[model samples]
Target: MEFLQPTSWTDALAAKAASPEAVPICGGTDLMVELNFDARRPAALLDLTKVADLAQWDIDDGSVRLGAGVSYARIITELSARLPGLAMAARTVGSPQIRNRGTVGGNLGTASPAGDAHPPLLAAAATVEAASVRGTRLIGIDEFFTGVKRNALAADELIAAVRIPLPVGPEQFSKIGTRNAMVIAVAAFAVALQPARKLVRTGIGSAAPTPRRAPAAEQFLAGALAEHDLWESRAELPGPLLDRFGDLVTAAAAPIDDVRGTAAYRLHALGVMARRTLAWAWRQYQSASPEGS
Candidate 1:
């Protein structure tokens, strides 16, 4: 196999155009595992790790743009305080070694339904940017994942960066798994409270074929909390409405009995996480709000 390291986007695109079948690599976190197991061996590799432009990240006008090569370490240490839910998700990914080498774009490229970043990005209403020799295109997070381990990316395209709209209120992430750290999640949840609009959005992972929203639960919460001005209203979410919400979320999930966990466990835990994280985020939202407001 041949490796081509290109420094510029144009050079990278030219290389891809010349050999359309060449595999593109940034952080080898996922690809390397396949390579080690002899699961895949591309005839050529277009290495984008050295590409300067694809590594740039910035925030502008309540939007965060992260380069394809941005590591989880940078996200946890640098972006945590700004985007707590995303940072929390990043921290839960892998060990120090995996975190150091893994890239957000790699997670998207792999398109695993259980990817740690997907739930947070889905809740944040993120968008992905991709470029090819032909042109550039933007895809919403909702439209990005097509199925389990599948995506809509074209064969000759590369993910440039991901752009997320900033949150208007407090957000948090939680997961349930067999082990504390470095273990794949049985169920993961992300909740964001948009107080200004009286809206609450929730994203679920691991329980579904694709990361998805708890629309019924969100609608229930929206109505339940609309009349209340204090975070104390969260205490009321664990009643019949919560039970129905759990059932709806579980029904939305397309889980199978895998080695990591049972379908029942995933369903039960997803409900619990949804309830707890919503309360947690509500409390945080109250704390951040001004006193006597």
Candidate 2:
């Protein structure tokens, strides 16, 4: 296959716009696997790693803009202070070697429901920024994932960056995999306690056609927290409320039996994960440290 490396995003977009069929590659952690398995063979590739702009990041005004080429390693080390949930999810992505190359943007390019980064981004209420010859557009996380292995990105558009507002309180992520490292999740979940808004955001992965937020669970928790004034206190979430939160999260899932896990088991695991992550995040919220200390 012919490889075309562009030094800048403008050049890269022009190249992709000219050859919309050319596979756009950044880290190649995902694309290379498909190529090696003979699942795909594009005539050409648009390699964006050489573009300096796509590898840079900016943090300002309680928001972070991560470039498409920002690897899992960078997110874990540099962004952990600002995006603890994403950093925690990044830690579980793959091995050290895989993390060095694999990127959140690569996950966006593939749009796999099993991707570890998806749930955290969704829980953060992040935005995916995409650009093409036509121009740039920002898509909300809820609208980004349309179906299994699909996203809102168009054929000629490339992922430019992801924008996330800083978590106001504590956030957490959890997953159940057959094996911990380097294994796809049987079911994974992320929860972010937004104290400023008195909102709870939950993202369910692997057990859905697309990674999605558990809106019912979020609404339920929000009402309970507001009633109890838990957002400002050290009090624990009530047992009954926690149980119902897990049930609501489980109800939002539509899983299929696969080699990794059964649909029934996946639903059960989602409930457990949702409960655990919410408890952990609440504990973090109670901590004196605003940085989840």
Identify the leading candidate in terms of lDDT: 2
Q: Can you tell me which runs of candidate 2 are displaced by over 4 Å?
A: 289-293
- RMSD of each candidate relative to the true structure: 2.2, 1.6
Q: Write the per-residue lDDT of candidate 2 for residues 44-123, one digit (tens) a residue.
A: 99999899998999985677999989999999999898999999999998899989999889998899989999899999
lDDT of each: 0.82, 0.91
Name the lDDT value of residue 1 in candidate 2. Answer: 87
Steric clashes per prediction: 0, 0
TM-score of model 1 (CA atoms): 0.93
Please write out the lDDT profile of model 1 over residues 221-289, one tens digit for every residue.
Answer: 777676554444434444665566567666667787898899888888887887678767766765664
Question: Which residue pairs show collisions in model 2?
Answer: none
Residue 182 accuracy (lDDT) in model 1: 88
Lowest lDDT 10-residue stretch of candidate 1: 229-238
